[model samples]
Target: MELQLQIKMNPKLYLRDPEQSPLGRNIIQHSILMIQKIGFEDFTFKKLAVEVGTTEASIYRYFENKHKLLTYVIAWFWTWLEYQLLYHTNNVKSPKEKIQVVIRLLAFQLPDQFTFSHIDRNRLYEIAITEGSKSYLTKHVTQDNKDHFFKPYKDLCARIAEIFREYNPSYKYPRSLSSTLLEMAHYQFFFKKNLPGLTDFANAKDDAGVVQFLQHLVFSALKKGS
Candidate 1:
């Protein structure tokens, strides 16, 4: 794997830094694979410890619980995504073109060459699409927010929201639209795959059609008339 970049995720999500040592890295790498294979609901530290050749006590040294680990992985993802967005869009001049770029990046399939550390970019996307909501949609969300466990995601949203304002200063729902577009990218794909009746691209095997649909939805709303 290529050493392209390192994302410094929010520290509050973990007990010991997973990037600090080989054991920590192994924990993160294998946890991602396990969560993707077993689903988060069925995943447990005991199982993860067995997979990583470590004891449950050792795993607990890094993360408070499985939920914290989940949030850490997802937070790392958000930071990685924000980096990609800035790297790709740094030179683009127009806000309209920039926002368009953002939509495509968010909704597109994982490129085979993209990666960070030893983690599989493809599996990470799968986890994000299916399990990302669990990171925040919980009774603990209030306390998590207070701890800033969600800062990376919020930061990513804020960056896109700024572009929305740049595109149309008078638009009243820049933040709402920004967050909606982000969620829509994931939800639409999930709906298309699992609940055909919920989306127009029911039979679509890829995100190409959904990307076009998002472009229409966003630009149409940004248009002065509607």
Candidate 2:
């Protein structure tokens, strides 16, 4: 049997849902590669259309602009990540252990990950680390927020907060800590790799040290005031 994952994304996120058609899917799949290769600032609809072997108009039929497309891609990763958290933690009986699972997911994509056909989870992770905030850090962010454009990310944070509550029901800042934990995971990697002086793990080759640090940070917080 074959199974596929579906995320019920907000309808306002696109003019046409990319998952419904091949061309739309191609726009998504190739956009990730192009954005990764050239970066989001240099990435444009015209360039993406050329890479996808389609017209710029065709790309716009699915997304209003590069920013919306970036949001869609980031949303997909967050939704998928929320699902991954649920899937991975389903069998674990301990909240501490479940949190350990999440720290790992935030730091790096695990080997032998289940593949999503139209989305490259690994590249999307890189994009999320590098370009994720650009999606929301715009002039029209208030309107975008009203439309629930960032529900996926908020949902992921909410899920982690629940686990934190599970670990220590009396904790006052589960939601804040959850969101902060996610940001630390993304920024620390970016800092260590690109701006080495900003982080202690600058000399480290992989996120093993980052993951260890997160596990310590989270557990220490949950243990505090308890």
Highest TM-score scorer: 2
Q: Model 2: per-residue lDDT, tens digit, 1-226? A: 2346777888898999998999999999999998887899999999988888999999999998888889999998898888878778879999888998999889765442455687877788889999998998999999999999999999999999999999999999999999999989999999987899998899887778889999988999999566
Question: What TM-score against the true fold does each predicted structure earn?
Answer: 0.93, 0.95
Query: Model 1: per-residue lDDT, tens digit, 1-226?
Result: 4336767767778889989999999999999999989999999999999999999999999999999999998988888888778876789999988988898778754343345566876688778989999999999899999999999899999999898888888788878888899899899988987888999998776778999999897887777633
| Model 2 TM-score relative to the real fold | 0.95
Q: What residue pairs are clashing in model 2?
A: none
* lDDT, candidates in the order shown: 0.86, 0.88
- Candidate 2: residue 79 lDDT (0-100): 89
Report the number of clashing residue pairs per model: 0, 0
